[model samples]
Target: MATVFITGESGTGKELCALAIHDNSARATGPFIALNCGAIPQDLLESEVFGHVKGSFTGAISDKPGAATAADGGTLFLDEICEMAPALQTKLLRFLQTSTVQPVGATRPRKVNVRIVCATNQDPLDAVRRGAFREDLYYRLFVVPIHMPPLRDRGEDVIEIAQAALHRFSVEEGRNFAGLSGEVETLFRNHPWPGNVRQLLNVIRHVVVLNDGGLVTLPMLPESLPRSVQPPPAPAAAAPTDPASSGYVLDSLIGRPLAEIERIVIEATLARFDGSVPKAARALELSPSTLYRKIEGWRGA
Candidate 1:
């Protein structure tokens, strides 16, 4: 395959896609090396990607082969390519053109037969236009561009993926997981999922780790999840028609638990608004997200 450029939001599995490409390529038996350009300090990046001789720099105590050399005869996956410094970009472009790498403090260049797979969360063309990335280098690596869509656009696929994650995490955590509750599934479907699959995986893992699981429930979900995503609460029992009537008992909920009363009131308010969550929330003097969480818990129960 040609030099592959993968672009997507942070949690869209760009690196995972790169790994799949490597695993299915002719170099499957060879090593699959990965480097996160953004994670490394700028000063040490060159040496890390191009190796260094023992006396190359202040911290170069011994001869070291860099990622490019390590990935020889295999696949080299570079993540956050846009974060690479300009100087490093030039060096990378040269290496791509000549199929050779010049290690730090080394006079000689070494040849490597490695497939280049790069990824970035930013749009490369936009970065190029902004001059944050080199245009020529962008074109060179954009040979086989693959864009992974965020999870929210995948519709029901979100639930499918989450269910799989739930099962896997349950097994890993040694819990008897049945599955997600219906309310949890609806929440998953409606959630914007800003963190994508990575966030979903963590959510599932959080649920599994925090409680002994029978089924994943809304209360088990993280507090950070948005409240607008939750479905409106179920309708409450009808109120008494007359306040002064002997049958109209004002003490009907006298012995009810505070939590139960809260649930009933919230549900009734939600029903009064014809299932309009925001309207119900405003009427109930609660934030929409708070209402969502409360309703999620009630429905899950």
Candidate 2:
């Protein structure tokens, strides 16, 4: 039951890492308490971390156990530790050093035996230098540091995460989506994903909610996803080449029926041309009226 400090950028899943560690540790059977330092007010934050005695303040109605006391025989996870007030840092440091807590308006310190796990989304070194975080506390909490990489740095994991999220959303929504369409796969793979897995989960849920009864095609995707996030469309020359050579066979349409397949192809083409009907029609070797007719057909189908 070693203390750990997890740090990463926003959306990198620091809290998840903390839970994984706690659940895997020997203290798994004990209580697992968590607190968000940034969510509590500065005035009441100390009382929340280290409980106050009755009549200690305006809101102190009874002697309550703080997060530390609540996890006496287990783990106390402090998330967003960088947001803690400077005054609280000294108190927390003392507790970490002495393994004892002094509740507000209480003279005697109560001993506690608990493992600590702290998480933050900022650079602790920078915080310590800037005086926003205490150096002594930082050293005490930095025993076993674990860093989570951002979505961009995780490479091909993006597509894997999207597929997993899509499957989960499908099961949860009771939707029988054929599978992920090729266009959808490309979009998920190429996106920069600034919001990371959280954003991808939302997009997958949105698609599952709106899907009628087929694969999640490109047309179902949100319009707000940045162009930089979407992969460039397959080259026109590649589409007409031997299907086997290009790895796009009729059977590889992800079990999508012909109508859905055609719609996906046309929508992807339109997007490739930046929504220019004339250019899309010319590129597809169809008349403008024919392109309009195909759109109407797609909508109806």
Candidate 3:
């Protein structure tokens, strides 16, 4: 069986991908076990990964099968694999090399036939380079690498996923929800969701759980969300520069309409930045999407 390694940012569904792999593999009928290496204490990690015999230690009142033995015939997914201690890493490497596990305080080693799937949010190779992770163990688990894309880059899929979550959470909470409003849709599109799908799911659940929703609105969204979809503020008149060199006099801009002045300043900034919208937005102290939306509105007008 081949080992699969998954890499992505937090909440990008690394465990979900691992389950998909196991469900589609030849070991579909067998058991699938998962453990978060970073969530367990370092002292107890060995017993958790490999069973400890009775009377082995203070808490060893009974014999228990560890994750590797429990998933003997199927898949064992280890999330945040890089967080494993160095001693555990060496033992893990030995298990991968020989397909055998020796339980803690046990005299004999037992052979296990199971596929391994490991996932981490950090760069495994970089961890190896810094000596935070074992180089030999890295090679063993890095047989097949899969990288999950962040939600912001997935375009309309964000809305689709959010809508699905809305429907499901609404039913679970006994709320009648229609869908998102036009303004909320625009907000979702412009939002750079750093937490990916998990953030969107939580937002939807938050809306459903708190309010009896008909249609999700901008007010229903969390206060922490980025306000990039809102229109930029009107440009204010600044101190006069050399009118002859700048061409546009500050006094002239003062008497002009707000819309006209805003257009002139935005266009001038865009031109100054060589037609780069992001650079222009940075110079104007506005979000790139907000600047683009304003320019698009001006064009349509």
TM-score of each: 0.75, 0.72, 0.74
Query: What are the per-residue Cα lDDT tens digits for candidate 1 across 40-93?
Result: 999999998999999888988999999999999899999999999999999999
Better of 1 and 3 by lDDT: 3
Compare candidates 1 and 3 on TM-score and give the better one. Answer: 1
What lDDT score belongs to each candidate, Candidate 1 first? 0.83, 0.79, 0.84
Rank ordering of all candidates by TM-score, starting from the highest: 1, 3, 2
Q: What is the lDDT of residue 199 in candidate 3?
A: 93
Scored against the true structure, residue 90 in model 2 reaches a CA lDDT of 93
> Residue-wise lDDT of candidate 3 within 3-24, one digit each (tens)?
9999877877899999999999
Write one digit per residue (lDDT tens) for candidate 2, span 1-301: 5679987667878888888887988888988999999999989989998888999899789998899999998999999999999999999989998899999989899999989999887768778889999998998998998777666546678777877877888888898777777877777777756677788888888888888647878888877875345443442322344545555554557788877777667777777776665677678875444565455444345
Q: lDDT of candidate 1 vs native?
A: 0.83
What count of clashes does model 1 give? Answer: 1
True-structure Cα RMSD, model 1: 14.8
What total of clashing residue pairs does each candidate reach? 1, 0, 0
The candidate scoring highest on lDDT is 3
Screening candidate 1 with a backbone cut-off below 3 angstroms (N, C-alpha, C), the clashing residue pairs are 227-289
The candidate 2 region of ten consecutive residues with least summed lDDT is 230-239
Rank list by lDDT: 3, 1, 2
Measured by TM-score, the strongest candidate is 1
